[model samples]
Target: MKKNLFLTAIIIIVSIGTTKANSFKNNIYQEIKKDSARLSELDKFWTELSRTVREGDFEGYQAAYHPDAVLVIKQNRSISITEALDNWKQGFIDTKLGKKNDKVEFRLSKRIGSKTTAFETGIFYFTSTDSHGNPTEDYIHFEMLLVKRNEKWYALMENQKSEATKEEWKALE
Candidate 1:
């Protein structure tokens, strides 16, 4: 009889612990859902910015960037938003690349804060043919640190052109 009572007590304690754990998990899940919704909104803004880039709409892309934004190209180099825009414009003009088969796709990896900040990564695929009709592909990996400013999320810092592969993409998921 004593052994049975002890077993019952153990079961009761385990059940209570599981209930508490499940309650904590539910709270976390709800928080994550809220963050996901906010991230989705930010993702749309990022998508628009990418489309502007693909179309070579320098003005539109410039407008999306925060005035004091910094873009860090690999190797720890950083440039201001205006400088980056100028460089992009010059490159487009020099190459005469008129937005041929340019596409950008983004996926939300992880959201850190309460919709005030997010870490996102994505892939950009751009294709253009040379004078001899040779196909060219530019596949780039990009990451951005976004902050909510004036009720709008703006990318404060951006990093691009990392060695992006299919495996890396999968790992982000």
Candidate 2:
């Protein structure tokens, strides 16, 4: 009887320890999985964003940013968006005349800082025409901040800088 009681207590203690260890392992596994899942979700946004740009769907392109967003250019031109119905009007004008933003190449690097927030580093290469009607290419290195709100991802801020000291910044209110 004494031997049986001792064995029973030993089994209970071992079982408890095993259960705790497994729980800890599962938690760590979940965290690693969450990180990968977050990256995948963030990557999906770029796919959609590229599609919108390629299609020249201005509205779709605008949808990528939150409403009341701000855009700054070259650290000199800053614009706050509020019911910006004709915000991209100038770009449209240039495109209509002769200038074209016809091609783009996106190289994206994403990092998941949290379950609801992420950051992206990317280089965007744009092909356009020079003054003499020749093909010219320019690239911009940009950093972006994004947040998941209402189960949807939206860009909270985007800033771009070039070697020529050209900077473009966008923020949301």
Candidate 3:
């Protein structure tokens, strides 16, 4: 009878451990699934932003920013995104008219936030051609605060921090 009782206790302990392991795995899987969905949505946000730049869709570019958005330049000054956009409008027009071409690419160093908010740190490579077809390229480090509303992501604040070297840009994931 003692032997039988020992075997029963062992079985119960093993069963409890197995159950706990399965629960842990399920929790990990759920976390991964949630994070994957977040990344997918964020990718759509970046894709639309890049498309607007490449296609010279000024309105679409403006739409990517929240109405109350702010732009911080090199940690020195802050201004309304609307004012910044106005300054940039002529470049969009020039690109649309085929007088110039502009392109931007991002490489992230860090991205963190919840389902409705994100703070992204990245290096942006911006290239533009002059009317004479001469290309100018710059690598800039930037951080942006974004919020999702109604299933759409918009930039709430953009900080164009500083210039980065090509080596620095390539070091990020």
When sorted by TM-score, best at the front, the candidate numbers are 3, 1, 2
C-alpha lDDT score of every prediction, in listed order? 0.71, 0.66, 0.92
**Of the pair 1 and 3, which is ahead by TM-score?**
3
Q: How close is candidate 1 to the true structure, as a TM-score?
A: 0.66
TM-scores of all candidate predictions against the true structure = 0.66, 0.65, 0.94
Please tell me which predicted candidate would have the highest TM-score against the true structure.
Answer: 3
Better lDDT candidate (1, 2): 1
Q: In model 2, what lDDT does residue 94 have?
A: 56
The candidate with the higher TM-score, 1 or 2, is 1
lDDT of 2 by residue, 6-122 (tens): 999999999999999999999999999999888888878887777654555566667778876665444555565433426654443454455555455566644647989887776
Worst 10-residue lDDT window for candidate 1 reads 94-103
Compared with the true structure, the alpha-carbon lDDT of candidate 1 equals 0.71
Best-performing candidate as measured by lDDT: 3
Clashing pairs in 1: none
Supply every candidate's count of residue pairs whose N, Cα or C atoms clash at under 3 angstroms. Answer: 0, 1, 0
Is 2 or 3 the stronger prediction by lDDT?
3
